[model samples]
Target: MLTISAKEMKDVLYELFKKYEFTESKANLLAEVFTQNTLYGVNSHGINRVPYFIETVKKGIVKVNEEAKKIEAFGNIERWDGNQGPGIINAVTCTNRAIALAKKDGMGLVALRNTNHWMRGGYYGWQAAKENCIAILFTNTQPNMPAWGGKESRIGNNPFVVSIPRKEGHIVLDMALSQFSFGKINNYKLKGEQLPYHGGWDEDHKLSKNPENILKTEQGLPIGYWKGSAFSIVLDMLATLLSAGNSTYKIGLKEHETAISQVYLCIYPEIFHDQDLQHTLINEIINYTHDVTPSEKGERTYYPGERAANAEKHNSKNGMKVNKEIWQKVLSLL
Candidate 1:
């Protein structure tokens, strides 16, 4: 493990991206997002995935130069064709566009089709919240998990995000349908550590913390059990239908996960007369959750997004930790 300042890491990533023909603006934006993800303690989606992202670009699965094009527009909704562009850039653009629309209308929606994987969906949620807008976003992925009661992989562990703006810190919930994402499980396995909670089932169909067995079986348990499975199905359907793009089941037919669909929705509070009431209600809900007795002594319970904010502070002061091997590989790309 090695620790590097966020600025240094961002510069390194920018240099590497430039080597791949990304323009300065695009490179800087990508680098900043990646660095922020690491700074917020999401290594599984940050530096750990940068190497594969580069590989995807090299493989021609992700178009480095392609920009999303607006395909259709409604009163407060729009559809875009990503043209297989880099997912992070496309997602950020769409999220911003949604916020712009919400500024005019009370609500805005954007559906993007034919995009690559958007590492760390929470980034866009944070983007919207920064603008004082509520956001809901979803992305489809390659089928890596089975439907409920089935044995074969048939559903995407599609990630979803929600964010509500607040003065202190935005309340954001970013999670995949699966109880554990493969990237997260692999990270634990690499560290030879057990999961803090039950993540998945083994080949013997028993709950297990052994990431290796879970990976081999590909039988990840869904969060909230059947509820998450149902939610995944609905989210996949909504993304595909709204974007008029391929569903997770269709994407699974291919060896690589590309040409995925995503949706972003933003709502502005200024248009509503009850904005103050809504804000108060949100705070009340958060306070209620925090008031619960923690399972461990001296461990204060936190609302969603609390840990990320704390991580940002600690990482900014102490430098972000990076896996030595991954960092070297990223440098090699430069």
Candidate 2:
């Protein structure tokens, strides 16, 4: 295991990205996003995945300098095409644009089509929440899990994120339809550890914590069995139809996952209600939730994004724990 300070991580990765032909500004943005994810303890989507991301660029799956193009504008809602650009940049651009529209019109809806994987979907949630706006977003991926009863992979996990601003801390929920993300499973597999919960089924069709078995069988369970299966289908529908882009079914036909669809929504609470009233309500809701008795003796309940914020603070102070192998791979990039 190894650890690196956030400043070093960002500076090193920024230069590495520039070596790959990314513009200095774009490289800086990408490096910051990746570093932020690591700082927040989401290594599955952070520095841990940078090697593969760079490989995708080398393979031409992600156009290094491509920028998204606006397709149409309707009131506060707009559509964009990613043009196979870096997903993180496209998503950030759309998120900022959504917030800008909300600032002007009280709300904004942006749909992006033909985009690549956005990496950490929750990044945008935090992005909007920091601006004191409500945000909701989701993206469809290639078919990686089965639809409900059928054994064949028919739908994507479809990550979803929602963020609400609060004086104490932003409330952010980042989740997938599945009980565990493939990235989580891969991390467990790498560490040779068992999942604390039943994550998926084995090749023999029995529930298992062995990540390798789940990966081989591709039997990752949904959040609520059938319910998550159905929810994923609905999210996929919205992303595809709203963005006028590739559906999960069509993405399954591709050689690689690209041209995915995503949606970004932002609402300015000050426009709809007084800031004081919003804070009061937020406090009331949080306090009531906190009053609930703990099911575990040592565990305290935290709002979705609270843990992430806490992790960021801790990692920032102590430096980030990183897999030594992945760290070595990243160094080789330089």
Candidate 3:
């Protein structure tokens, strides 16, 4: 493992992205987003994923310097075409548009089609929270998980995120429908560790904690078994219909996962309710959750985004420990 500073990580990423023909502003934004994800303890989607992102760019699956263009509008709701740009850049653009619309109206919704994989959905949620807006967002991925009671992979383990602004720290819930995302599984595999729990089905169609077996089958376990499968289906339907974009099945036909659909919805709570009351209510809920009886001795309960916030603090002061092999690969991109 290697302990690297956040600034150093960002500087390397910026230089690498610039080599990919990304403009100065875009490179900087991409660098910060990737580095921030790592600092927040989500190495599965952070530095570890940079090399794969560059591969997609090289294969012409992801275009450089392309921005989302508005397709249609309806009052506070709008649809945009991502133009197959960098997922992070397109996601940021759509999120800002949603926030701007929410400020103008009471609520705003942006449906984005033809976008690539947004590395970490929570990044956009935090973006909205920083603007003091409540945000709910989700994105579809390539078909990677099977439906309930099915052997064939036919569903996407789409991610969902929600963020509520707070003075002390934002509350964000970001999760994939699968019990373990592919990235997380891969990370565990790289570390030669087993999952804490059964993460997916092995080739024998049995639940397993071995990441290698699960990845071979590509049959990740749904979060709630049947219930999670249903949630993934509905989210996929909503995203595809709203954005008028490719569905999971359609994306499965592509060589790689690209041109997916996503939705970003933001609400301006202060415009409707008292800010003080909102904060009080939020704090009460968090306190109540924290005060719950511990499931394990000597372990404290945490709210949705609490652990990540703490990780960001500690990692900023100290440094993030990353896999040496992956770190070397990222550096080689230069």
- For each candidate in the order shown, give its overall lDDT on alpha carbons: 0.90, 0.91, 0.95
Please provide, for model 1 over 100-170, each residue's C-alpha lDDT reduced to its tens digit, 9 standing for 90 to 100.
99998989999999999989999999999999999999998887777788867778789999998998789
Steric overlap count per candidate: 0, 0, 0
Ranking by lDDT: 3, 2, 1
Estimate candidate 2's alpha-carbon lDDT, on a 0 to 1 scale: 0.91
Using TM-score as the measure, which candidate wins? 3
Query: Each prediction's Cα RMSD?
Result: 1.4, 1.1, 0.8
lDDT of 2 by residue, 95-207 (tens): 99999999999999999998898888999999999998899999999987777888777888899999998888999999988899888888898798998899877877778
Q: All candidates' TM-scores?
A: 0.96, 0.98, 0.99
Better of 1 and 2 by TM-score: 2
Evaluate model 2: give its TM-score.
Answer: 0.98
Candidate 2 off by > 4 Å:
none
Model 3: lDDT of residue 273? 64
In model 2, the clashing pairs are none
Please list the residue runs of candidate 1 whose C-alpha ends up more than 4 Å from where it truly belongs after superposition: 203-206
lDDT of 1: 0.90
